[model samples]
Target: MAACAYCGTTILFGGIKDDDLRFCNDECFENGYALVIARSVSDNVVKREANKIYNGACPKCQGIGPVDVHVSHRVYSVLLYSSWSSIPNICCRSCGLKSQASNALFSLFCGWWGFPYGLIMTPIQIVRNIFGMARPPEEFAPSEKLENLVRIDLATQYIEEKSMPPPVNDV
Candidate 1:
């Protein structure tokens, strides 16, 4: 029996892809694929960051000034192999500009897949493109407003309680 390349489990001769297969089953193959893709996405993100720091020039004003960028990946639990499982995006803090790294990445992958623009039409691909675009202040500032509101409310409550009369015992 050959060992599965991913899980290291023994592959039975009659089970799934037979004993000669590298993976024991489709699940193992897909899990391995996800790991590979996720790693690829992370590597791409690192490259992008390095480029932004070392080579990314402003396309609009052509001024390289305080360009803040962040990259992250999301895994689609239900997607199959090559089903838009990993996504990455870039944001420029200087000009508040954001762009989908995944779209370009996906486009490249689709080209490799021999599909014409297949990456853009995928739901996850579309989402990946849209997500990085200039988001609202709240989108990035998760609790800015909430924190201010809580502070105000606490101040108001303190004032009201301080102004109230002491409790009187009922005979």
Candidate 2:
């Protein structure tokens, strides 16, 4: 099994690129190569819909454009780097609480890698992740209208974005 070049996670189904590097998804590949992220087709659609919602009022503060956007990045174990044991989230910059939560969880399990960076960073991230999850800003908070088609689009975008090497057999 090849390991992901970005996070060092074992790649079970990802393909090899340039005859050497392997990544689970474009996210990892981009991270590995330090390339700009390539947004998939659905990402544009969600951005359009989300813009439509934010176009009106803030979900939390009822303010405007500078509002925060929440995106989830999965964390892999620094020690194991196995797909089976990812921490689910690495950080959410929009909310400080969620940042901490994700970090703390990672530190608890992967804090001993290559010195003490994990120990130093995990606690901070955990607090942020949990706090963000628990008390998102008014603008970031979920709204009743958020549960409709907008949500479906976002979910679809996430699923599609994560599906490395898009499927050829479109149905």
Model 2: lDDT to the true structure: 0.46
Query: Model 2 compared with the native: what TM-score?
Result: 0.29
Q: What are the root-mean-square deviations of the candidates from the true structure over C-alphas?
A: 19.5, 10.8
Model 2 regions lying over 4 Å from their true place: 1-48, 51-68, 71-106, 139-171
lDDT of 2 by residue, 110-138 (tens): 64453344444445554555555665434
How many residue pairs clash in all the candidates, one count each?
Answer: 1, 29
Cα lDDT, model 1, residue 143: 29
- What TM-score do all the candidates reach, one by one? 0.25, 0.29
Predicted structure with the largest lDDT when compared to the true one? 2
